[model samples]
Target: MTPPITYDGRHLLADLYGCPLLGDAALIERALRDAADRAGATIIGLHLHHFGEGHGVTGVALLAESHMSIHTWPEHGYAAIDIFLCGARHDPDAALQSLSDHLAPTRIVRHLIRRGEAP
Candidate 1:
């Protein structure tokens, strides 16, 4: 007998710069949904937060596979994004790529962490 080949997922953390903070929340949310859909993930829920002075954060994207989150610092022109999807057929990379493209960051640092694997 053999152990089942369980599919592990990756958690992506991205540090981005040069992101425009003005009137981009709707666009960002749309892009996130599109990405998740393309990756075969269901968008169960979403939340967006806006700072009083045209700066703030957004998060709470619940996906069937897992979840996606983002925090924005418009004052510093930076944003941090996290995407975690757990499933045998979810493409987290594609979701991240879509976010990067939509944000149009001048510079980006991304880290991928593997989770739920046997040690």
Candidate 2:
């Protein structure tokens, strides 16, 4: 019998649609904090920038395990988010769920990828 292989971490790519507050930088930052907490990921730093009124926001949360990034398209009511964590203790799904709760998007699509495989 062979042992199962495990990678160093997980990477989640998520697309959210029909989001109403895509231009809100403060809200997005708060959501990132909530997401990090839900995933049990330690937050090292955070940054967010809003292009202008009726535009969009870009944000990133630097975590001890890895990072989470979010970019929004207000006109399209869409947001693309990435959550990557490098430890077994973190749950990217939980983080995504938290984001969904805060953003209240009508539709969401996401994918999970295993990261850091040795050749």
Candidate 3:
């Protein structure tokens, strides 16, 4: 049997297109940290990985509420991002906007998921 899913929080999934220079892990990390702060979320830790020169980056910011993560494809000019927070006290949409502003993507598709819901 599959495990049940939770709906006690909000999760924002985003696909960013037409992004320029997606290989900078440090910049993405900073942007996420700033976004978390703007959303009034307490950040616990952050982890980031760079694929290689002119390749891509993957990053995750562990927050007191939950976590936010991002992966990029410089060659394709695309990025996938997830901003999941465990309560309404923080705005995941606002955090997502902050990241969009920092990255300046030409197109963005975002979806919000309710987590920890009763079965």
Give all TM-scores, in the order shown: 0.86, 0.92, 0.90
Residue range 1-119, candidate 2, lDDT tens digits: 85555667899999999999889888999999999999999999998999999999999999999999999998999999999998888999999999999999999999999887654
- TM-score winner among the candidates? 2
lDDT of each: 0.79, 0.94, 0.89
Stretches of candidate 2 off by over 4 Å are 1-6
Clashes of each: 0, 0, 8
Q: How high is the lDDT of residue 62 in model 2?
A: 98
Candidate 2 global CA lDDT score: 0.94
Model 1 C-alpha lDDT per residue in residues 6-118, reported as the tens digit of each score: 66888988898988753367776886787788778899888887665677667668987889888888777788888898875888788878887787888989998888676
Q: What shift in Å separates residue 49 of candidate 2 from its native position after superposition? A: 0.8
Residue pairs in clash, model 2: none
Candidate 3 or 1, higher lDDT: 3
Highest lDDT among the candidates is held by which one? 2
